[model samples]
Target chain A: MLKDITIGQYFPGNSVIHRMDPRMKIVLSIAYIVMLFMAKGFSGLAVGVVFLAICYGVSHIPVSLILKSLKPVVPIILFTAVLNMFFVEGDPLFQWAFITITKQGLSTAALMSVRIVCLIAGTSLLTYTTSPIVLTDGIERLLSPLKKLHLPVHELAMMMTIALRFIPTLIEETDKIMSAQKARGADLESGGLVQRAKALVPILIPLFISAFRRADDLALAMECRCYRGGEGRTRMKQLKLTSRDIVGAIIVALTIVAIILLNIFFPLAIA
Target chain B: MAAITVEHLSHVYSQGTPFEKTAVDDVSLTIEEGEFVGVIGHTGSGKSTLIQHFNGLLKPTSGRILVEDRDMWADPKKIREFRFKVGLVFQYPEYQLFEETVAKDIAFGPSNMGLSPEEVQMRVQQAAQFVGLRADKLEKSPFELSGGQKRRVAIAGVMAMNPKVLILDEPTAGLDPRGRDKVLGEIKQYHKTQGNTVLLVSHSMEDIARYADRVLVMNKGKVAMFDTTENVFARSEELAAMGLAVPQVSRICRGLAARGLNIDPNCYTIEQAKQQLLALRAGKGADQNA
Candidate 1:
């Protein structure tokens, strides 16, 4: 049933974070990702955690929802943690046959897991809070300055918006296609890997054809509506960086600064 | 025993999410064997959702669907068997036909059922015959067929399975009147020959009245009414309130009845109206001549 797919999901809200100019939010998200990496020692990681906590609190998005998004990536997180714990060479903390857990290895494992989790969480918050339309609109405007370099920013953004908008459409189409094939006794979920993959051909072929047809129709419809490449296309809602966005950016920047200073000035306890 | 029995079924889509919605509220119905049942509702009235459950295509959020008294979801793993038992033709089924040749496409279901190649070939020919697909067209690529033909071929894929309960969700949709009649005629013929239960979900009131013996009117995810065509069409006002119209001819008859005509206001078909009018005229003539 492909139930666990959480991509392109949005959380509708009236929080200050949700209302911010998506352009400002996008840039701030980048800053937050950097701050996550900058955090090294325990003090530094603490600052990163507090900053992420503040962002989450302001967004008004439930903690459980964020944790739910982390479900799909749990195995990856564990893999990274285990790899760091067992592979990194340092003073041995626990010697168990061939695999040795070192003090530095454990610390690296902990910090890396935290960094990866925070990175995913921060990026996801932007998507979860801001509607895809607004996000794409902001991206188009931000990338407009690059049009002189022939970057096709408008086209790219338009494509992204259309793709984001059609995620549900495609999912519904897939469900329909699955049902259609199922009526014909297509046993998609059962069988071995090869059989399963073969079964998906019926679904995938129809889906691909339909997607292409939809794109063609959408293009024609866009032309009919006189949507000519974002040129002179005035948005109904203009993007403006509010005080909340500026304040959020400032907090994130300060956290990064504190992490850098902590790494520079303090000796690590584990070391 | 009825071919299909739904017992107090309810469905909530995306349950527990902020965008959660209840599509079908508690609805129970029994579709008698060999009877043609039409499910009519406004868009999102859960007609589609309800039909999906009847065939085991969808697992109900709560409640049971019984195909000849056997629970549909008793073993979810064997849902494929249920599908063969209840053939579901989804709207725009042509889009689902992926095989290269018409014969191959029609044989998909029987082939998937692990039938022998010879039996699948026989079923394909029989299914094509049932849908009135020409023998010459069997070898052609499905993409070469016209819209209506493609729909038939898609439908034939399921019909090839020889299901006991055949359900079609808007089989005649997007087709011209001639095309619609062709498809409907085939469905009625299929029911007559197969002696199986037929559940048709459609938005067209006329189509339902024309073919279905019993009509289940869905309104806001609940069974608003379940009765014979004559009775259901008689409650035109209630249907109107639910944003559904009575059959076209019945609407006209009701309008005429309201304006002091001694016509049968409950008649929903053209043939019924004609017979009633002839009787009315005969009665008037008898009075005048006497």
Candidate 2:
């Protein structure tokens, strides 16, 4: 029953986005998010919508998957939209006993909802196209400059890679343990709050024990391989920015510039 | 009466997505009460997925499962009770133990059934005895026990529920020879004494040949063969084609048969092979005397 989580999952594909340099993809993802926040009106949001559509088309990732990633944050989107609709004060469109709806509030609410959806879709594209190993490699390389400040960049990346690799293993282990417990009639579904929390005792204890056991084994295996921290380590696949990456960067730069110009020149009527 | 019946059952994993694939496909079988059935298949052949359906652990994508002629999904609310009646001990069950003491761990199932404390204690002791665990060891923490001992405790935990039809998925997996024998022996004893149905899922043909009365051969998510142990082993070549093999004794018998010896190729155990060889010798001696 714990299999519904799709966060941090990567989809394998042979698209241009997948082929781009991982570091460039990371930068573009951050740039896309910043562009969404910088946008002000319908014309600006239109740029984001067009950019995301182009990305979806080029990545070959199904639109449904991008929407699936937004499922968990749907409540937050709705909550913000509702709050903005009723709380913002401007030319009132409708007035009730204790509530008033304004044109500005309605416009702000629409803009906020569109911005949130675009923001999630844009970031999800990064993870969908790039594998975890490549993503971490990119992150470690990007953060390498911070080593001058004594930050453990390589170690942190190593930890993240290990964690990502074990997610599926731990999930499969948890599934097995849950089935074993359920076969013995452990009531996990029906119970009060306290009873439910108590039921987790049987699952949690075993899970924690196995996790530690796995960690110990991994440490031993790493020691056997002489894995001395990230110092002087060489990678088999070097990350290099090619002509395609430069062209992609140019397109993103042009899109961001166009968004800024559009926000300045083609402001929405409500704003 | 059939202890369990699967009718045209099919299970698809991650349906409606790119990962959609059928794990079990239109499989149907009937298991009689008090019978020991062995399910053999290669990895990803749907052996694990099929057994999980017996206890309502997995809902069939199409068709139904009947336990004692009653539809298992007829009353979804009481499905937990069905689990008590059809206990499933998964592979590497030792990892499921969590209670502080072995006794409490064994009692977990019975307590979940809301039995009286006294009855729970009685069942726990009975299960421990069945598994060859000493009474004194019950007070110790489960974490303190060795790997094989911890596995026994986990098995006893399910046995404490006294399920009518016990399904074990590779119970002997990862155990040493002696440990494997001990666990399999206890399962045989439990079936014999309690007269309850047992479904053993294993990849080892020898284990099934020695213990199972009937064998169910699964191939590519379908039931390829289901018959008496002798009959299934008789078609060892077909099993081999499916990436399975017969017992070593059966292979030896097949070799003798190939050399024109009048021995049954289906002789699986050592005792059967010995008798076949002795009979062949007697017939040869009689012919020479004539």
Highest DockQ model number: 2
Question: lDDT tens digits, residues A211-237, model 1?
Answer: 998999998999999889867788788
For model 2, residues A1-271, the per-residue Cα lDDT tens digits are 5777654669999988899999999998899998998788799889889989998998899877887889989999999999999999999999999899999999999999999999888888999999999999999999999999999999999999999998888888888888888898989998799999998888889999999999999999999999999999999999999998999999989889988998889887455
Clashes of each: 0, 0
* Docking band of candidate 1: medium
- What's each prediction's TM-score? 0.92, 0.93
Q: Which lDDT values do the candidates have, in the order given? A: 0.88, 0.92
| The best candidate in terms of TM-score | 2
Q: Give me candidate 2's TM-score against the actual structure.
A: 0.93
For model 1, how does the per-residue alpha-carbon lDDT over B1-290 read when each residue is reduced to its tens digit?
88888998999988887778999998898888889998899998999999888878778999999998899899988788888999999999999988789998898889899999999999999899989999999999998999999999998998999999999999999999999999999999988988988988888998999999999999999999999999999998899999999989998888889999899899999999999889989999999999
For model 2 the local lDDT of residue A146 reads: 99
Where does candidate 2 stray beyond 4 Å? A263-271, B260-263, B276-290
